[model samples]
Structures are given as structure tokens and as C-alpha cells.
Target: MYRLKQMNTLRNQIFLGFMLVMLIVLGCVGFFTYGQVSVLLRNNAEKHIQQTAVQAAGKLDVLLRQVDTFTAQVATSATIQRLMAQEAEGEKTTFAERQSMLQEIRKHEAYTTGIRSLELYTTDYRMLFPLTDVSLNSRVPQEWINEADAGMGRLVWLGLDPRNPDVVIAIRNVRLIDHSFSYAGYLMVQVEKNYFEFSVEGESADNGSGEMMGLFDGAGKLVTSDFPEGADVEGMLHSGAKTIELNGSTYMPIQKRSEATGWRIIILTPVNYAAEGISVLRTVVVVSVIIGGGLFLVMTFILSTMITRPILNLIKVMRGAKLGTLKPISVPSSAMEINELNNTYNQMVDSLNELIEVVYQKEIVQSRTELKALQAQINPHFLFNTLEAFYWALEEKGEEELAEIVVAMSGLFRYVIAKTDGDEWVTVGDELDHAERYLKIMDMRMVDRLSWSIEADEECRGAPVPKLLVQPLVENAILHGVEQRLGRGTVLLRATPSDRPGYTRIEVTDNGPGMDDEKLLALRCSLEKGLNSRSEGGNGVGLANVQKRLMLYVPGGEGLTVHSSEGQGTTVSFEIPNAHKGEVES
Candidate 1:
């Protein structure tokens, strides 16, 4: 019982809730921060390794291409080609001829650095540099010779020498620059391993990071490495893994292939180096969470006491409110929100009795007003009959024109004021009739100063539209466009099947002076505002009101458009979607 009572205390509950929320938040933040930081560091490390490998490979390719160019220069020299042609023609070369060829080979040795040797061989089986050593000739592999022959004059990389394993080899077959284009001889260039190793080492030393790189041949054999000896290079190169475990340490491997030499350059980066930042961040996060949790618990205790003490005082004061005593009670607290809350409660208490009395008075007045409104109601049919009686009385007195005006007025009133059961939709023909009556009344009232015409498609006459849809446009035309002009004006009402399917176009055009750009712009702005505000129609509906009503009544309706130029006629048009309705009696 005592534990339950303690748990029910408001200050204890608030402190426990805040502590629980803080713990969950810290745990989630730490988890996500650890995962995200680790991934980012790993990616950055791998990207660095990849860039290093590509740079090294690019340098090596430049050196190898230099050697290739030198070989091409010697193979295509005019003296060497002529001598090779002589040898191919079964002519025995004199010592002077062989010496000329030896000079030609020696001239190219200085073309590029790190060149171990350059040898040229013909069908006669002679080494140009060593003159009499068959061992130099014997060292040339038959497979290299065949591959060179198949090259048809283009250079091909033969990779590291298998016998010595310390030399890089390249060869190309030469062709005579003649009409026959006959095969000449083979030119082989041997590059020292130090040529490529020097570049890789220089790049590694410049980086200053403890990362190692190795160059592998096309067959995945390690040709040279900046890695320490016996570093399991073969397993690292062939395992095809992104990360490797070497000596119980993690390393990320990035490999790039050289387009020039078809060799693979592999770089290995220490994972520990990349994760050092992650370790520091982890320690900071742990310490911050512990310190923040302790401070949050202390603050939660202080805040709960400040909050619950005010609430308890307010509760004690509100106990009098339930007994129908309408009196203000004040609760003082240091918190701004608590003080504001107390002020609001006191104001509500002071206004409670006044509000009850005011509500009672408003109900009595509302009942009396409703009774008067009911008593003032009249049948719509009586007004229609009275107008008809006035029309006939004017006709009997030989005032035919006045009688016609009276009939049109009666129609205008009936259509505007009468309810069509609960349905707001009417046929286009009925709406046109309403517009015609309104136009007739306006034209008669203007003393022959106003005239109107309506041209409607027979098919469009039966389409459904909101009642009074067309009458307002005609009224607006006569009042604003025609009456505002100096002389007679004409209003043309056109109804036709719209180009858009399942729609009808209605246009009201006036021949009075049109609006200038400024007035037209203001009028358009008014219509747009009306559409947004959804202003409903009144007895004196203007263009904006008509547009709002059209938008409300017609499905998929876009309201109205006005086109006008100063001193020219104005045209207002709108499209209404066709709606299915019951047939109307003629």
C-alpha cells in the first residue's frame, strides 16, 4: 500500500517519466551514431586507398609507354629496315653491315631510362649487341617470338621474365615500309624490375601513411611489392575480398588495372588508422551521456517540484468551484506558463456567472426573433398572381409596351425568388429563358438604348446548369457595360457545344466601351478573390459572384474568363459540365 501511494505522487511520476525518456533517447542516439560514423570512416578510407592505387598505376603506365615508343623508333629506322630487308633476302651481312646494325640498337638504348637491353633478331640468328653470344639469342622464348610475330608490328607486353624473374619484357615484330609490307624481324626490350618498383616506392613514401602497394601481372602474380617480404601477397591479391585480415589486423584492399600494361595495382590500408576517430567519438558519447543523464535527473527533480506544487495549490482552490460559488482563486508560481495558467483560471471564474446570465438572455431573444420570422413568411404564388394581374390591367388600358415589361419583370422575379423543390439544377433552355426575361426588362427600361441577341445550339439547350447562371451575366452586361456607356449597347449571349467533351460553352459579349488594362486586371483579381472566398450569390449578383456560383454548382468547372481591349467590345465566357437530369415539360 505504501509503494502504491509513493508511485501515485505527481512529482515522483514526472521525474520517473523524464528519466525513462532520457535513457531511451541516449541509447538510440548512441547506437545510430556509432553505426553511421563507422560506415563513413570506412568509406573514406577505401576511397583514399583507391585513389592512391590509380595514381601509382598511372605513373607506371607512363614509364612502360616510354619504353614502347623507343622500341618502335628503332624498329622503324631506315638503316635498320634496309639491313633487315637484306638479311631477309638471303644476303650475308658483312662485319661492317652487322656493326651498322649494332650502332642502330645502341643508339636507342639511351632513348629511355631503366632499359636493361634492346635486342633485334633476324632469320640468320644473330644478336646485334653481343655479336657472337648464342646464349643471348637462346634466352628469347619461342612463345615471345610467336606472340611478337602475331602482333603484325604493334607492341605487346610479355610481362616479367620467367627465368630471371627480375626483368620486364616487351616485344614487337617489324614490317618493311615498302609496297610489299613484308615481315622484317623481332625487336625485344627488357626493362629492369627497378624501373616499376622505384615509382611505387616513391608514391608510398610521399603519402606518409602506413599503407602498402603491390604490382601484379596479368596472371595475378606479384611482380613487385612495396609490402614487407613474405606478406601473403598472393592470398591478398587472389582472394578477391574488399577487406582482409592479416596477422590479426584488419586492412582494406583497393585494386586498379592499368590500361597500358594490363597489370593490377593493389593497395592495402590499415583499418585501425581509419577507425581512430570512431574510437574517440565513442568515448566522448559515453561520457556525455553519463554526465547529461545525471544533470537531467537533477533538473527533472527540481522542475517536478516547481510544477506539482503550483498544481496542488490550484487543485485546493478549485474545490470551491464545484459548489456553485463563482469566485476567483489566485495561484502564485515562479514559472511563466504556470502564472499565465493561474491568471486564465481566475478570469474564467470571474466571468462564469456573467456568461450564464448573458446566455440566458440570448436564448430568450433568439426564440422571439424566430417567432417573428415565421409570422413574416408569405406564399410565393401570391406574388406571381399579383404581377400577372398587373400585366393584364396594363394591357386592357392600351399600354401594350408597359404590359410586356410587366410580364418580363414577373418572370425575372419568379425565376429568381421561386424554389425549384430542392433541386438547384435546371436545363440550359430554362436558364436561357431567365436570361432573356432579364435582358428584355433591361432593354425596355433603357428606352430602346439597349438590345440583346442569344444564339444557342439546339443540342446545348437541354444541358443542365445551375439556376440563374445565365441571368446574372446578362444583368451585369446591361448594368455595368451598357448602362455605363453613352449610347445604345448590344449584349450577345452564345451557347454551343464546347470543344471539350461533356461540356457546354456560354459566352456573354457586349459592344459597349471595353475595360482598359488596369480595370480588367482589377476585375480579374476580384473574381479570383471571390473564387477563393467562395462568396455565394445574392439578388444583385455581379460577375465575381456568378463565377463563384458556377464553380460551386458545376462539376469540373473552371469559372469565368474575360477578354477585352480598350475601346473594343468585352467578352466573358465560361464552360459548364453537362449533368444528367429528368426531362422538363415544355
Candidate 2:
């Protein structure tokens, strides 16, 4: 009963853990995917709305241009110009002349199809075209007259007519075209407000629910709108192409500015309609998560039973063996492998006592042999040469200097061969110490020509880095920079905190003849491409190897960097993220 309870507890814990992890992963993925998809849909809707507005604006511009063209045609006619010139001469009014002038004005208005009304006014405010209407002779608005006169010949929008609020009027100044273009009169053209409505209706026909469009003048007053309740005129004027909330619903509004009339064409669509696909996706994700979770629970329960049954049976046999009963045992299982394992365990009880001593002795001998084999892999010639050099140094130099060199060499070898917890990393302080040892060996070789210094920040010493990360870079500096120089040179190694957080920067610099631009560019290209070996006449193989290792082991460390100019020194540097700081210290 206790074992059964333990098995159920284990199964429940494992199932819960797996479910928790799956829920987190799926939730994050669904959230970000939904956000991205929603953004894409909104952007596409905005583009479509903007395109529609642009087309509508284009049509409106064409219509306005046509109005201006027709007004110019009538204003510049010879029949109107001759009568205007005659009227300007202050001749006693002749009925035939007045009738001829009125006939000319009517003839021009008849040719223009969309014009609701055309009225010709002399500069003195005498109405010409609608001579029969007594109200037409009323005093003309001074604002319209002044704007028309100021236009100089161009058409000017006089806004909606106050007397007939449904009409939008444009006016042009009439002038005689002899030598001096004298102001003769003004010509006004009126268009019904419904004309603008018809112009934009074709684009809005296919738009779905909560879709609306509006034409607003430059001052943001609505001239026409398709929606019965209209839009938030103030909000539409202040906002650009974006999504907003209106009347307890989300809306996406797009505005296109027309250069001809200084008007704005706005199209508003509901956000729900625009993101229809996202709604379906959200539903699918919810349903899939629910179904997937249920199936995972059922599968987990079955697998747990299969696994724990064999394990429990093995435990029972182990308990029996522990109680000193060395007899054959049997436990039935549905799995063939588990049954075979049970049979093997029963057979092992009979011979375990007999083979214990033999197995212990064999393991002891095997461990020793393996240790000796690993030690044998070290090159004997290199060790002999190192010893011979140590002997020669002892004979030539005194004990103190030779002893220092020997110690540095020993330290370098120890660092190279040391193993730590199966990880290929060390502290920055240890790596620097290894680099210093290498430089010390080289210093003895060059004696007077090579001088070096290693400067590292106290805080950075404990930062974790890959083993032997800096030694190769220092070696490269000595080989490529110091060896190629004529006079004495200095190599500097510096470790500091990097610009990015949780990273350290290590730089190796040499005060020797530097590379030219072409060579520098080629070397950088090779390093960036992760070229393993240096090209012919190239001197960056060691640096490349170090860069590749750093990139492999360090998460955010971008390989190495080299900066050099002709006749100046070179600086090679790289960064290491300070991961596993505690591990390195321990």
C-alpha cells in the first residue's frame, strides 16, 4: 500500500511539472504570435484605407479642376469680354446690349453639367445671368467679392453658400484682355454638396459594418459623411492613420490630405472587422491547448504506471537481497526488457558473492593502467627539451632568474593540463596568470627587445572565461608585431569591464610596426568568416583560433577585433560574458 501511494505521488508530480512547463511555453508563443498577427492586420487595413482615401481625393481634385476650367472658359469668352468692356465704358443702358450679355452668360452655364447655378456679377454688384430672379440682385457678400478680386484670375473657393447652405461655390475674377487686364466682373459657380458624396461612394460600397468615410475642409468641418451618426469630428481631425476607441468599439482611421483643396478624406473601420482572422486564431489556440492538455495527462498517467511498476518490482528484489536471502527471485512484468532485467538480477544474486573480490582487484589494476596511458600521451621530446633548456639556463644564469623562468614554465604546463568539473573554463585571473607565464618565457628569449605588462581590474579578476583564452593572443602579438619590428617594443595586456553589462573586455596591444589598410581589411574579413587557418602572408591564425573559442563558449561575446594603422601599433581585443563566475571561484 505504501509503495502504491509513493508511485501515485511520483506520477502526479511529474505530470504537474510537465503540464506547467507546457503551459508557460504555449502561453508565451500564443501571446507573441497573436500580437504580431494583429499588428500585421492593422497595418494592412491602414494601407487599404489610405489607398481608398487617395483615390477619392484624386477624383475630388479632378472635379475641382474641371470647375476651375469651366469658370475660366466662361470668364475669358470674347462675347462676355466685349459686353464687360462696353459696360465698363459707362454707356447709357441699351436693352439689346443687356439681353446679349445675359444670353452669353446663360449659354456658358448650359454647357457645364454638374453646376447647380451660375451667376455673373458686375464689379458694381449687378446680377447678369439670373436676371429674372429678383432675389439674385440682393447685395453680394463683400468677402466673396474681395476674395475673387484678390485671386487675380485664379479660382477661389468661397466655401458653402450661406443663403443656399447645400451649395459650395467657387469664384473667379473677370478681366478685359487688351493691353491692361482691367477687372470687368466676377463669375461664380455653385455645386451641390451631394456631388462630393457621389464622388466617394464608389470606394465605400464594399466596406463592411462600422465602416465610414468623411470629407472635411482644411478647418476640419465635415462637408459630407456616409454614417448617420457621423464620426468623432474632433478626434478624426486630431488623429492620423491609427486605431482608436469610439462609442464603446475600436476603430482604425486613415486620413489623406488633398493638396488641391486643402481638404482631408478620412476612412474609419472597426478593429473587430479588420482583425477577423485573429479572432479565429485565438479560438483555435484555446481549443487546441485544452485538448492537448487532456491528452498529455492521459498519456503521462499510462507511461508513469508502466515505468514505476518495473522499478517497484526491482526494489522488492533489492530488499530481499539486503535481508541476506541469496535465492532465485521472479517478478512478472508486461515489458519484455523489464522481465529480462528481473531474470538477470536473480542470477546475479547467486554469483555476486563469488565475483566481488575479483572485480575489485581488476578495477584497481585497470585504473592504474588507464592513468599511466593518459600520462604517456604527453610528448617526451618536448619535456626533454624543456628540461634541457632549464639545465642550460641554470648553468648560464644564476639560480634566482632561472628559478623564476622554471616556475613560470611549470605553471603554464599545469594550467594547460588541469581538469575542472568537466568544464573548459577558468577565472580571468587564472587566464591572465597563464598569459603572463607565456610572456615571461618569451621575455627570456627576447631579453632586451621585448617588454610586456599585464594590467587587469580587481573586480574583473573573478569573471569566468575559457581556459588559455588570452595566451594565444599574446603569442600572436609577440610573433607578428614584436618579431617584425627593428627596435625595442612593448606588449600590453589589459582586462576591464566591457561596455555591455555582465561582460569583460580583454585587449592585447603591441607597440610595433602596424599593418596597412589593405592587410587589416583582409585579416578582419578572414576572422569574421571564421577562417580556421591564416591565409598566405597572413598573420592572424592564432587570433582566429582564440576568437572561435570565445564565440563557442561565451554566449554574447562577438569574436576578436583588430585595429592598426601603418607605422602605428596594433590593438587586438575581445569581450567575454562573465557567466559562471561562482563556478570559476569554487
Candidate 3:
């Protein structure tokens, strides 16, 4: 209150104080909001990742069980037992015996691949191996075998078959014959790791790196792993237990799997994917900060405007004077205070002019000014010169069609030189005609090496667009493209009306040497940017400028676009909100 009294006479100081307090308050709120949102985001993401990983693990569990079930079914099959007996009861057969038995097992494959090799070992402690002797190096998984020795019997998961990586996951079954309860030779089917990886990865895009979907033996021996080469799987994840870890680096993982195989199917996803809702909260807070900041400015500006309406008007005039907006004393409005400022601005301009005149000679200045003036006239004069030549050709060859062409040419020149009379928009027909004439001029200049076709719905011909809408692009297509190549080029102009959202479209296509997407993009950026750069190739590349002008005059006027590919043709199109005949004037 005391400071307010001290700065009472300083209105801007008071307003600044208000704005500063608002900024600090708004900033504090925004900061706290960001924190809360970020925490929520993290929590939600972690939770979601955990859930998904669990589900994926469950699916993988089913796959492992299916493979196990199939492997058991194949081994117990009467045919496989008979094949094993054929080799077992015979005199020591050659390597062919095991291969033949293995082939017999393969013949009865389920959805899962059958065992690559079958083993036959007798209770007498003597062994019968397949042609490939698949049982040569096959050892019962120590944990399961130990349990089997300890009478911990049933079907159990063996970690993997090291001899063949294909059999990364396998099962061991101990059955007693004649009440002896002896260990039987194990039958292992190779499961393709990549096939499962591709299947799961296809569904869950980001599950690659952190997700470990592989099987380990019941004894917890490392068997098959999808973890990147050196990731310590045995220690990180163990059978019968699942854990979630998100260090907030790249991804957060939610793990799910079957304890049966010690086989893990983990869905490791980016924490963000899990925490999408939390991100939304953060977004809301950020949006709120922006909205609050905006509201603060709005309130402050409104308060200031109400309190200092008269003074702000004075300041506007004062600033305008310095900016030369009041040069030669031009403030046409009739407010008393405004008039007074206008007078003061005129006096300042007069004072400046008197001072400049005292310092420079007229001739040196006039020559420099004239050079710039002439340079400005060069492009327009050259363009007009081309138009004039085209007009004469039309008069000589197409006299009946010359009137509309002449009128469009006149309108084009008039819009350029005398811009005030040009409305914000003109009819589509006029714009199309202007494009035709521009293309015609190019064709005449290039010995008619190009052909053009104009297509538009009759109703859309009256759709309004900013003046000189299609002229520059059509000119560029011919000057830079059609004429650049010697072959006869086709320029197709099409207008389409859409009823779905009630929009009209204009498309210009060219069959000249179409540019690559990069060059086309560059041209588009140049068109949208409207930077007044002369064409580097001397082909009058001013498509950017015309599109920019269209956007300026027509609200929501995103009405120019180009599509092209090398060796293919090019098409440029734009959409307008409305197109009604008789609704627009040229």
C-alpha cells in the first residue's frame, strides 16, 4: 500500500508491479503442477507397463506349455516307440538308424515342430542312440534329474539343449516301467526363437531390448535368452517371481511369465507408454500455465486500457511519430488528442527534413534513388512485356478468344500496380483465366512447346480466392519445368468440389521433367515463405510469394500445394472452404 502511494503518479510502474506479482504466482502454480503431473505420469506408466508385461508373459506361458505338451505327445506316440524299438532291438545299426527314427518322429508334427532327434536308452544302463545319436550329449537337466533321483518325479522343464540351439526349451518326463520307476531318455523339440520373437514383436512394437522372452531350466541354468547378448538374465529375473524396473532412462518393464519353464515372457515397454495418462496431466498443467499466463496478460491489459485509455492513445501516436507512420503529417482520424499528436509528429518530420536538406546535394541522391526505382520496375516491365507478346499472338491467331484473355491480362497488371482497388478475393474463373494467360505467355515465349488443359466445375468457377492465385505456380511450371525439357509437356489444371466437408479443390498437374520431392519441398517452402529471392535458375520462381499473398487475403486459405516425384509427373492442389457461382467478383 505504501509503495502504491509512492508510485501512484507512475501508472506504468503500478501496472508493472501487478504483472510481476501475477507472473510469480502463475510460475509457482505452474511449477507445482508440473511436479504433480510428472509424478502421476511416472506412476501410471509403471503400472501400465507392469500390466502389459504380465499379459505378454502369460501368452508366452501358453506357448511354452503348448510346445511342452506337443513334445511329450510326440515322444509317447506308439509310432515313435515302435521306431525306437526297431533300432533298440537290432544289432548295432549304422548312423542311418537314428536318422530314420528321427524322420519317423518328424512325420507326426503338431502345430509345434516335432523333435529333431529321438533318444533310446534302456534300463540295463546300455544306450541306443539315433542315426545322428541325438542322445550322445543329451544330459538330463541337473535340477530335474536330481529331483528325479530324489524321487521328485513328474514332467519338468529342462533349460535347453546346447547341442542344438533350436531345442532351447524342452521337457523331461520320468515314467516307471514294470513298477521300477526309472529315468527315460528325453525327447526334445527345437522351438524357433526368431519366429516367436517376430510374432510377439510384431504385436508389441517397443518390446525388443528390455523384454527377455526365453526359457531357463528348473535348476535355474541359463538356457535360451532373447536378452541382448550380455544382459544378466539369471540374476535380473528368476523363475516363479516377476519384478518391474524403470530407471526413468529409456524403457520401463512389466514382466509376466510361466514358472513351469522358468521360461520368461516379459513385456518391457517405455515407461511413458504405461504412463500416458500421467503425461496428459502434465500437458494439462502446461496448458493451464499457458492459459493462466494468457489470462494474466489479458486482465492486466484490460485494466491498463481502462485506466489509461486516453494516455495509451497519446503513446500510440508518440511511438508512431518515431516510426515515421506520421510522416508528412498523416493521421486521418478526428480525435482531439490524436490531432494534437499528429501536429507534433508533422513538426518533427519537418524538422528532420530541414536538417537533412542542409547536409546533402540533390543530384547524387537522385541518381542513387533512380537506380533502385528502375531495378524495382524491371520484373514487372519484363512480365508485362511477355504478356504483350502473347496478346498479339492471340489477336493474330485466336481473335474471337482474345477479349477474355486481354481482360484477364489487364486485371493481372492492374492488381500488381494498383493494389488498393484489388479486393481481398476474386472469382475462381478469374484466377483460372489469369493462370491460363500466364501459361500462354510462357508457351508463346518457348515456341509453344507445352500444352495446358483447364478443368473446373462450373459451380466452383465463382469460388473466391485472393487475386493472382494460380499465376505464379503456372508460370513456374512452364518457365522452370515445361521449357527446361525439350519434349512437349502437358499442364493439366483441375478443380474438384467435395461434398463430404463442403470444400473446393484446384489441382495443377504437369508432365514435364518432374522434380524430386526434395526440390519440390524447397519450392513449396519458398512459396509459403514468399521470400523475395530471384530465381537462381532465371525461371521466375515466385510460386511462394503468390501462395503467401493468398493466405494473407483469404482466411483459412491453405490453397496451394505441390506433389512431384522424379520420372513421374507433378500435381499441385489446394482446397478452399467454399466455391459458389455468382458469389465472387473478379
RMSD of each: 10.6, 10.6, 19.3
Q: Decide which is better by TM-score, 1 or 3.
A: 1
Candidates in order, TM-scores: namely: 0.55, 0.48, 0.38
Q: Would you list the clashing residue pairs of candidate 2?
A: none
lDDT of 2 by residue, 138-229 (tens): 64477667767788978887667767868887878788897288887777788888878734446545565456777877657677777548
Best-first order by lDDT: 1, 2, 3
* Candidate with best lDDT: 1
Off by over 4 Å in 3: 1-25, 28-48, 74-107, 123-125, 129-144, 147-153, 169-171, 176-199, 205-249, 271-284, 297-586
lDDT of each: 0.79, 0.76, 0.61
Off by over 4 Å in 2: 1-8, 86-95, 123-150, 180-183, 199-210, 229-232, 239-250, 302-586
Which of 2 and 3 is the better model by lDDT?
2
Instruction: Write the residue-wise lDDT of candidate 1 on 1-586 in tens digits.
Output: 9989868988889999999999889978987898898889768866766777778877878887788888888888888888888878878667788778767777777657888877777754465544665543477677777777777888888778877789988878777886277886677788898888743445556655667778888767778887776788668656787678776777777778888667888877777865657888889789978998999999999999987987787678778777877777776778787788888988887688789999999999999999986665565677889989999899899999889888988888888776556567888899888888877777777877898899999999988887777877777777667877888889999999999999999999998788999989988998988843221334456787787777666545588999988878789999987774433333
Residue-pair clash count for candidate 2: 0
Give the distance in Å from residue 63's predicted Cα in candidate 1 to where it truly belongs: 8.3
List clashing residue pairs in candidate 1.
Answer: none
Worst ten in a row by lDDT for model 1: 531-540
How far out, in Å, is residue 293 in model 2?
Answer: 3.5
